[model samples]
Structures are given as C-alpha cells and as structure tokens.
Target chain A: MIMTVTLTILCLLLILCFVTTSIIPTPVGACASLIGGFLLLSFIYGFLGAHFAAVIQIIVYAGAIMVVFVFVVMLLNVPTQDLPKVKISLADILSILLSIPVLILVSIKILNWQAPMIDSQNVEMKDIARKMFIDYLWPFELISFLLLTALVAAITVAHKNKGSRYMLKEGSDHGR
Target chain B: MTIIFSIIVFAMVLIVGFHVAPLMTWVERRQCAFIQRRVGPNRVGIFGFTLFGLGQPIADAVKLLFKEDGNPSYVQPFFYFIAPLIPSVTGLAALMVIPFGAQDTFFGTVFSPQVLSVGAGFLLFFAMSSMSVYGVTLAGWSSNNKYSLLGGLRASAQMISYELGMGLSLIPIVLIYQTLDLQQIVYAQSHSYLFGFLPDWGIFRAPVSFFIFLITIFAETNRLPFDLAEGEAELIAGFLVEYGGMRWSLFFLGEYAMMFAFSGLISCLFLGGYSLPYLTHESLIHIVQPILGSFGSIAVFLIEFATLIVKMSIIMLIFVQVRFTVPRFRYDQLMKLGWVTILPLALINLFVTALVLGYSSFK
Candidate 1:
C-alpha cells in the first residue's frame, strides 16, 4: 500500500515536471525540467521492475541525448531576446486534441491494470540482450541500418558545400 | 535500521567526496612541484610536522570560502548559479554504486561498503558522469563570454566522444563477468588467479581495454592532455573564465571529486578492488583470527578498506603525474585520439576479448 502511494506520487510529480518543461521560457530551464522528468520516469520504471529500461532511459535520454541538445543550444548561442514567443495556435490546439484521446486511453488502461507482486528476481542485462537478439533481431538490425543511413546522409549534406571546391578544381582541369 | 544504515553510508560519502578536491589540490601541486624542481605550499603549515604541506588543502579551502563571490552584470544569474552544483552532485552520486570493500555481516546486520549496490552499477556511474556535461556546458553558455562558450563546446564534444570509448571498453568486462554488479565483479576478481601467481585482475585479462578506459577517463574528467575544456593558455580557464570565489571553488571540488570517483572506478574495475595480491578476505580473516580472536572479521574489513584506499591513492597519484608529464593535445588531435584511435581500438579489444573467452571456454 505504501509502495503504491509513493509510486502514484512519483508519477504525478513526473507529469508536473514534464508539463513545466513545455511551459518554461528559457531553453536551459526547459532542458533541465526535461532531465528531471526523465530521471523521475526512470525511477518509476525501476519501481515497475524494468531495471534495464530504467538504466537505458537515464543513459540514452538524460545522459547522451540531452547532453547533445545542451551542446547544440550552447553552440547556437541563441540570445534570450531572440527566443520565440509561445503562442496557442491551431497546431497547439490540434496537438492537445490529439493527445487527449491518447491520454484517456492510457488512463483507462492504467486504471484497469493490476500491479504485479514484487518479484525477488530482478531483470538482468543478459535477458534484455538475449531478447533483443533472439526476438527483436530483425528490428534491431533494421534500426542500426536506418541509423547508418541517417549518419551518411548527414555527412553528405555537410560535405556538399565543401565538394564545390573540388568541383572548381575539376572544372579548371577540364578547361585546361 | 535500513534508514540508519543509509544515513551512515551517505555521511561517509559526503566526507570523502567533499574533501577529495582539497586533498587532490595539494597532491597535484606538490607532485607538479617535484617534477619542476620547485618548493610547493611549504609555508602554509609546519614544515616537517604537517606531512609535507598536507595542511595546504585546508588553507586553500579557507581562502576560497572567504574570497569574493564575483558575478558579472551581463551573465544569466540562474543558470550560472546552478551550473557548478550539477557536476558536484553527479560526481558524488556516481560514488553510490562503487564497492569500496567486501560486504560484511555483523550483529545480524549486513553492511555493504557501497551506498547503492544496484544491478546496473557501473552503467549508473556512466549515467551520472555523463550528466556532468551539463555543468560545463551551462557554465560556459551562461557566462556570456566567448572563451567560456568555446570551453563549454569543447567539453561537451570531448566528453561525448570519449564516453563511447569508455563504454565500449567496459563491454569485455561485462561479457567476462556476466554481471553488472560491481560487488560481484570484485568478488570474481578475488577468486581468480592468472598462472597461479598474479591476481586475475581486469588489467591482466583485458590490458587494451584498461589502457583505453584509462585514457578515456582522463578525457572524461577534463584532466591535462585532454583538458581543452579549461585550457588556460588559449581560453583563460575555458568555461570558468567568469567564475570566482566559492562558485569557482565548487567547480574545482567537482573536478577532483570526479577524479576521485574515476580513480576508485578504475581501481574497482581494472585492479582487484579491495583485495590485495594473495590476500583474499577469507585469507585475511584466517590470518587475523589467531591474534585478534573475535575481532578478526572487523580487522579484515578495515584492512580491505585500507587496501582499496591505498590502490585509489596510487591511481590518483598517477593522474597527477600524467597531468605534469603529458603536454596538452591539440583540439583536432584530441578528437582524432578519441574517435579515430580509441574507439576502434576499444571495439577491437572487445572482439579479441570475446574470442579469447569463447576459445578458452571451449578448450
């Protein structure tokens, strides 16, 4: 009963932090809030016996992805004066409208769901790795391929302007 | 009872984490001085009585505490204020999973030297250490200075790049141990012997991974040779250009705390952790039992704890020595080292380790 209450409170607090991230004016503030939400969600996941998922959530989202986001924000050096003002447009309304049904569906599912008895055996890393390789092998391989393609695409786009210098040299050679 | 145990563990952590910076400052300075043939911090305390200017860290702490807390008018106040705290918090948090000594049972209560013995122990450490990038990045961005911005950018990029190598290097250890629990890893190391003489430490088993991990950690901690984040010559202390007094001291504390944590981690993973050569916990207990009687277990714990601390101090000394010995790598060179060299080397080491382990098992 105590665990249930604590988990509920944690979930509520996580939602509050998540909402605050959207509402925050400063990019740093929003990012920090998002990090907090990620940590809290990881805690919730850990409590639900998804230990590997919890660690991955923190490692991928809070650690790697957020660090990159912060890096980009710092690099761009976007002045506070240049920050885009938030406005409740049709898109915002549409997003809220779209999210409401999903929220309701999730809430209904959560309400009906019974909490499993706390198990002594924690989820191990090998189990996750085995499942990923055996059951989700195709999807995992496909995702890696997709990531590789995206990386190549990004490099190609970055190199395009630099390629003009080589093109100029080739053009002179052709004229000669 | 559990709450009381947690409080005790936290207290120990705080005491160690908070003091590491000041202690390391003295160690670094004295070590650097020895390298350069100069006297260092000898005037602060008694010459011979103070353990060769050991009191220097205390004096430095006092000076830092009383110094002016300077804040520029143009800087972003909130981010600037919170930035330094992030590194210290994360650095300290990473310590929670690291086992300092063997688990002990005393008076019907079980005590593990570490604060949190989670299933994903080292992974959690990685997660916390990665979060430290925010502190550097935010400090630079909020300072409203070009040098600070550059410093932050270098730090984020350096940390991100090296982290891949660091993570990859540990894959072999995980594969060998077949567990992520640090205590289990340490226990595993204690039991195994290489050729009946040397301890089967991770260093011996995966020397390449150890080297890669050591180098990556130097980059991760922003120490010399990889400390482009705070390159004094080029960027005027890098992301720390605008910071002064206690705020600056917080960053200093965080850096050393990270150094301490990483050293502990290196000792834990590569070294035999709390175990000495041929001095397993059971052996220690056996050795002490005749003399100490009922206090044998307690004595063994103390000895193991001291052994770990000694190992950690040795690693810390190496960190200081390397800081003085190695010249700072150029920015391109640093990136190339991490991505081009270390990453591929770590991957190869992983593959080699897997092959060796598989072949040996089959044989």
Candidate 2:
C-alpha cells in the first residue's frame, strides 16, 4: 500500500514536471523542470533498490550536466522569447499518429512485466563496485572510453574555430 | 523514545547550525580588527561592555532583520527568493550524517548523536555540497545584472573544478579506512596508534591527501584566497549584489554553516574524531570508572563530545585565521591551483597510498 502511494505520487510529479517543462516560457525555468524530472526519476530508481544508479543519476546528470545547461542558459542571456505558435501541421499529426502505437506497445509491455523483488534494504557500494569491476568490466571500460571520446570531441570543437578567427583578425590588422 | 531523542538531536543540530553565523560574525570581526591593530566591537554592553565585541553579531542580526526588504524591478522573483534558501538547507542537510560523538544506549535505546546515520555518509555530504552551487548560480542569473551573472558563473565553475580535487583527495581516506561511513571511519581511527605514540588518524596515514584535502576545503567553502565568486573589488559581492535584509543574511548564514559543517567533517576525517590522542573511550572509562563508579561511562561520553567540538572549533579558527592571512587569488590562478596543481597531486597521493598499503599488508 505504501509503495503504491509513493509510486502514485511520483507519477503525478513526473506529469507535473513534463507539463512545466512544456509550458515554462524561459529557458532556465524549462531546465529547472527537467532537473526536477530527473530527480523524481532517480527517487523512483532508489525505490526500485538501485541505490547506486540513483545516486549516479543525481551526481552525473542532475548535478553536473544540468548545471552546465544552466550555466549556458545564463551565458546566452537570451531575452524571454514567447513560445512558438503551435500549428497542427501534417508532420506533427503524422508524428503523433506514429507515436501512439509505440506508446501503447510500451505500456502493454510494462503492464505485462513483473519486477524482481529485492529483499535487501540497502545495496552496498562494495557489491556494486565488485560487479562493475568483475561482471560488467568490459561495458564499464567501454563507457569510460566513450566519455573520453566525447570530452576530446568537445575540446576540438571549441578550439578549432578560435585559431582561424584570431589569424583573420591579425591579418586584417597587418593589412591596415 | 528513540524518535523523541532523534528529534531532540535534530533540533540541537539546527539550532547550532543557525547560531554559528552570528557567532562567527563576531569572531571574524574581532579577529580581523585584532590583525589590523584596531579595537573591535568594544562598546555594546560594558568595559564599554563590548564583551570584546561579542555582542556585535546580535546587533548585526537585529539591524538586518529591521532593514528594508527590497526586491529589484528587473529580478526574476521566484528564483531570486528561493536562491538564498538553497545554501542553508543543503548545508544543514549535510550536517545530518556527521557523527559528533560515540554511540550510547540509554534506557534500552541506542542513540547516536547523528541525525542520519547512513552508510554512504561521505558521498551524501559531497552530493549535497555540490548541489549548493545551484543556489549561487541561480541567484546570480535571476538578479538580471551582469556582475551577478559573471559572479555566479565564476562561483559555479570554481566549485566544480575544486570538487574534483576534493573527491580525489578523499579516495585515499576511503581506501585506507575501506568504508564510507563517517562513524565507522572514526571508530577505526580510535582503535589504532601510530608508532605507539600518536593516534593513527587519517592525517598520519595519508598526509599528502590531508594537504590536498585542506586546500580543497578552503576552495569548497569559497573562503578567502578562493572567494573569487564575491570578489568585492571586481564583482561587488558577486551573486549577492541584489540580495538585501534577511535574504542576504540567509546567504551569510549558509556560508558560515557550511564552514562549520566542513570543519566538523575535516576533524572527523583527518583528526581522531571525538577521541583525544592516546585516549580512546575504553582508556577514559578505565581511568574514570574507579573514581566515579557507574557515572564513568557518562563522563566519558561528555568528554568525547567535548573533544569533537573543540577539534571542530580549532579547525574553524584556522579557517578564520587563513582568511585574514592569505590574500585572495586571481581567477586564473585559482583555477590553476584546483585543476593543474591539486588535481594531479591528489591523484598521485591516492596512487602512493594504495601502493604503500598494499605492500605493508602483503609484507
């Protein structure tokens, strides 16, 4: 009964977050709503006994990624732009129609699935660490490599244009 | 009964956390004055009754409470109002998992001084403190001022950069103690002695980590030398430029609360948390039991509690002293210290600690 109540509240919060994200006019507000949604999702993960996953979700996603998003939003300092006029174009209708079947399929699959009962009150970090290093070692290492690749890509993208821009400015000054 | 005791303890923690701001305010004022060769706060009550300006914090609080509460026209109302609250709430929440003294059973109920005795206390602290960046960032953004925006950005970036060093520094501690639970770490420290003389505290085991951790602590709290977020000459109070009255005080309270909490954590981690050198609870009990009979245990508990508080206060004093002694760092210099210097040093410290521990155990 308690679990049912908790899940119900979480579902309500998730819906509220989704609505807020859509309705909020400002970029910062939308980002805040997205963070709220992530937090709620992590709480649900915690409820499902994925304590380590829940914390990683908060730390890596909500804490780090969303912070950068907020930083960029502030940096851009975009004036409040009105929401784009909603038009039910052919593409939108087609996409909505296509999504309905997928949504239904997902819901049906979820309803048919049974979650495994976890008797442990708390998942130990050691257990998670052992599993990460042992059973999931290859996947974990792959993820780290993927993260490193992304970091390098980001640095390259940021650095590539700066040198050329500086060179063009220097050339213009020299010509004058 | 346990619930009631926990409630009491939680209330005490909140009261202490809130009061720390005013107390530290007086301490800072007096200390700064003394360093500058000026008389500080000596006219409030007597010898002018100034109580050495001890009453200054109370005066400041009253002044702040009575001052006009102003909201600027351009500010985003929601974020502006909520921003100050974030730091204080997160600061207090971080304090919940810190065990201040030895666990005791009274009237058939086991009571630990900590409000939340979770297994992952260390990570919880890091997570909450990391979240505090949002408050400063949002405050700066919502103010709709350029200075505030820049301040917020610098603060957030600085915090994020230093957190890497902070976490890496802690790796050696976790590796040594082999537990994330703060209380368990404290217990481990109490049982061992270094070379049969000094307490086998974290500092003794991982001095390099301790040094890196000390630097990160200063950075984490955004104290002097690291207070680029609110550089008065450059940013004009940074994120707090628009805040006034009670709202500004809330941010002030939050910073001091975090300072106290971090000090407690440092004492718990590097110092022999709640234990005097060469004096475990058992040793204390052995000495006091014959003199006081059944009251020895109670005496020991009080002594342990006092020891922890004194240690924390000493750490706080160091924080205040360093704030006055060291000049603020340049923005780029601050970044270099965290990312370039502390980060690599912490990584090397972790590696060396692991190597030494492994070799010793094998031998």
Per-candidate RMSD, Å: 4.9, 3.8
Report residue B342 deviation for candidate 2 (angstroms): 0.8
- For model 1, how does the per-residue alpha-carbon lDDT over B1-363 read when each residue is reduced to its tens digit? 666766887788879888889888888888889999999876667555777878788888889889988879999898899999999998888877778778876556777778977666688898889888889999998898899989999999998899999999999998888788888888778865756787878888788889999999899999998999999999989999999899998998888888889988888888989888766777777788899887777788788878888998999999999999999999999999998999999999899989999999999
**Model 2: residues with Cα > 4 Å off, grouped in runs:** A48-50, A82-88, A109-122, A149-176, B46-50, B289-296
Tell me the spans in candidate 1 whose CA falls farther than 4 Å from its real position. A94-102, A117-120, A143-176, B1-3, B46-49
Minimum summed lDDT over a 10-residue window in model 2 chain B is located at: B44-53
Q: Lowest-lDDT window of 10 residues in candidate 2 chain A? A: A167-176
* Lowest lDDT 10-residue stretch of candidate 1 chain A: A167-176
Interface-residue RMSD per candidate?
A: 1.5, 1.9
* lDDT, model 2, position B175: 90
* lDDT, candidates in the order shown: 0.86, 0.84
Measured with C-alpha atoms, the lDDT of residue B96 in candidate 1 is 74
Error of 2 at B149 (Å): 0.7
